[model samples]
Target: MNSLSAPQPVPLAQAHRLLNHGPTVLVSSAHGKRRNIMAASWSMPLDFDPPKVAVVLDKATLTRELVDASGEFVLAVPCRAIAEQTLAAGSLSGRDGDKFAALEFETFPASRVAAPLPAGCIAWLECRVIDEPQVQHTYDLFLGEVLAAWADPAEFSDGRWHFSAEGRRSIHYVAGGQFFSTGEAFEVSVTG
Candidate 1:
C-alpha cells in the first residue's frame, strides 16, 4: 500500500506520537483462567523516556479487575473496520466468559506481555504497570510502561502513520458506535 506521508525512522522517543491524538484503544489482560478485552478512550502518554502511559479504567469494569490482579495489559489501537467490535467490547462484560470468543474476535501474540493483541488493529502496544497505585485504587486509573509496540505496515511505518483508505484510518471514539477518523493532516509553521 502506497502512502502519501513520507517515511522516516521511528525513534524510540517519538513512539508516543502513535497515540498522541488520543484514539480509543483496546485494553487486554488475563487473570488466572480468565482473560478480558475492553475499550478505553481516556488514555494518554505521560513520559517519553522509558515510555509511560496512563489510562482510565472504571473500577466496576471487568477489565479493571483483571488488570489489577495481573498487573499487565495490552493496548491495541483498532481501525475503522473494527469500530463496532470496539464498541461492543466496552458495552459488554468479560465476567461472562472469554469476551473475545463471545464476540468472535481474533488475536495475535505480543512480544512482551501475555495478553494477546486484537486482530485487525492498526497498532499494538505491550504495556506493564508502573507507579500511582493510589490513583489506580482511587480513580480507576492505571499507569504503564510501553515494553513493545508494532504497527500494521500498511498504515504505519517509520515514525509516521499513513492512512490509505477510510477503513484503514485510525478511529477515535465519540459515543456509542460513533467514531471519527484521524482525518487529514494540516500543519502550521511558527515564526519567532
Candidate 2:
C-alpha cells in the first residue's frame, strides 16, 4: 500500500494535537527478531510540554511483551483508508507468526525507537516507556514519553489537522467491527 503523503516532523510541544481528537491507534513494537502491532482505543495524552501518553495493553498480548522488553513503542494513527488492515492487526497474534507479513502490512524504521512505524498511518509517535511496573502489572497500563512525532502533511500540518480530503481522516473504533470516521471541523471562541 502507498502512503497518502509523506510524514513531516511535529514539534514535541504540539505532539498532543495528533491525539487530542481521540483516534484509534496501532501500537507497534520490536525487540530483536520479535515485532508486533495491535490496535488500541484506550490511548490518550497525559501531559503537554514533555509530552507523555498512556495506553492499555493486555497482559497476554505480544505487544505488551515487546514493549516491556524493549522499552519502546510506536503509536501510528491509521486513517480510514486502511481501517480493515488496522483491525486485522489487532485481531491476530504475532506469537503465531509475523503479523505484518501475514496481514500484508508495510512499515518503516522509526528514528528514536526500535519499533517499526506502520505505513498508511496519518501520524506516528515514537515513544520510550516510562518505568511504572506497579500500574503496568496492575492495570495493564503503560506510560511513555514522546520521543518523536510525525504527521502526514496532507492530514496534519502546523500542529493542526486539515482533513479536507476524503478517506484521509482518522478513525475511532466503537466495538466489534464498528468505527467512526473523524468528521467536520469546528472552533469555539472564548470571551473573557
Candidate 3:
C-alpha cells in the first residue's frame, strides 16, 4: 500500500465516502496487449449495493477507446502527492505512448479487472462496464458495476475519511492546473 504508515481496514459499504466530496481520479484500463491510464474529474457514485459508478470520458481519449473495446477499467483515487502528474495525464495523450510509464507511476494488479491500480491512490475501485451505447456516444459517459474496492486505512476507514496530512488527502480538479484538496469534514444531522 502507498501510505506513510500502515493503513487500517474499512467496511466496503462506506467506500463511497472517499468520492463523496468529488476528487479527480486516475482511470486505468487494459485490453490484451494495450493498456492505458488517464485522468478524469467527472466521476460519481450512481448507486450503493453492488455499487455502480458513472464517469465521463471523452470519446477521443485512448482510455475511452480501450475501455469501450474491453468493457473494464479501474478508478483509482489519486492524492495531492500526484496532483501534478494527474494534470499531466489529462493534458497529454495516451496514444503516443504509455502515460503511466511516461509519468513514472507505479501500479499493482487489481483483483477483478485487468487494469492495474495506480500507486499512491488512497482508494481503488475495479469496475466492469454496464454497456449503454447511447450514453457512451452521446455524453462520453461510462457506467460500471464496481466489482471490487480497496483503500489505504490511514486516510480512509469505516467509510469515513480522515486526512492526517495535506499531501495524503484526495485532490479535486478545478480547471487547467488548479485543484482543491479534499477539505475538512463536518457533519449535519437532519431533523424531521
Candidate 4:
C-alpha cells in the first residue's frame, strides 16, 4: 500500500504468486501485548491448493519466540520505499522494545491472523503455523498454511506482478545495508 494503492484480496489460489519472485519480506508476529517485525529473505511457497509457505527463524530472535507462542505470523512483501525500514527490522533486536513504534512503521489489521500487516508492503500473506516440531526445532524452519492474502492491486492482480516505477518496485536484500529493487520485467515464450 505504498505508492501503489490500497490492498485488495488476491484469490487464495493465487496467494503463492506473491512471493514467487523471491522478494525479501517483513515477517510480523504478535502475542499478547508484544509484537515484532523482522526482515527475512529465505521464505518461499511450499504448496498450491492449500497455499502453504516455509520460513526460517533463528531460535534467538524474539519474532520467532512470538511466532511460537501465538502460532501465527504475517509475511509482507516490502517495496523500495521502505527498504531502509525493512533492513532496520532485520537488524535490530525486538527484545529491547516495540520495533513497530521505534521504527515508526504504519500497519493495518489482518483479517485472519493476529499479526498486523505492514502498510508499505506490496503484498501480504497471513499464515497460521503448521505443527512440524521436528523441522522447527532442528532447522529453525517453520511451515505455515496461508489463511489469507492481500496485495496492492496496482502492483499485483490477476496473478501477475507489473512493477513499473522505482517506489513501486519490490526489494531484494543483498548484504551490508544494500538492496536491489526489482528490475524491468520481460516475458519469454515457450517453444517446442
Question: Clash totals for all models, in order?
Answer: 0, 0, 1, 0
lDDT of each: 0.81, 0.92, 0.85, 0.93
Q: What would the per-residue lDDT of candidate 3 be over residues 137-172, giving only the tens digit for each residue?
A: 999999998888888877887677888789988998
Off by over 4 Å in 4: 1-3
Error of 2 at 8 (Å): 0.4
For TM-score, candidate 1 versus 2, the one ahead is 2
Ranking by lDDT: 4, 2, 3, 1
Candidate that scores best on lDDT: 4
Model 3: colliding residue pairs: 8-153
Model 2: per-residue Cα lDDT over 1-192, one tens digit each? 357777889999999898999999999999999899899999999999899999999999999999999999999999898999988988888899989889888888899999999999999999999999999999999999999999999899887999967688899999999999999988999999
Give the per-residue lDDT of model 1 (tens digit) for 64-103: 8888888889887777888888899988988887889988
Q: Which stretches of candidate 3 lie over 4 Å from their true place?
A: 5-11
Question: What is residue 39's positional error in candidate 4, in angstroms?
Answer: 0.5
For each candidate, give its TM-score against the true structure. Answer: 0.90, 0.97, 0.93, 0.97
**Sequence-dependent TM-score of model 2:** 0.97
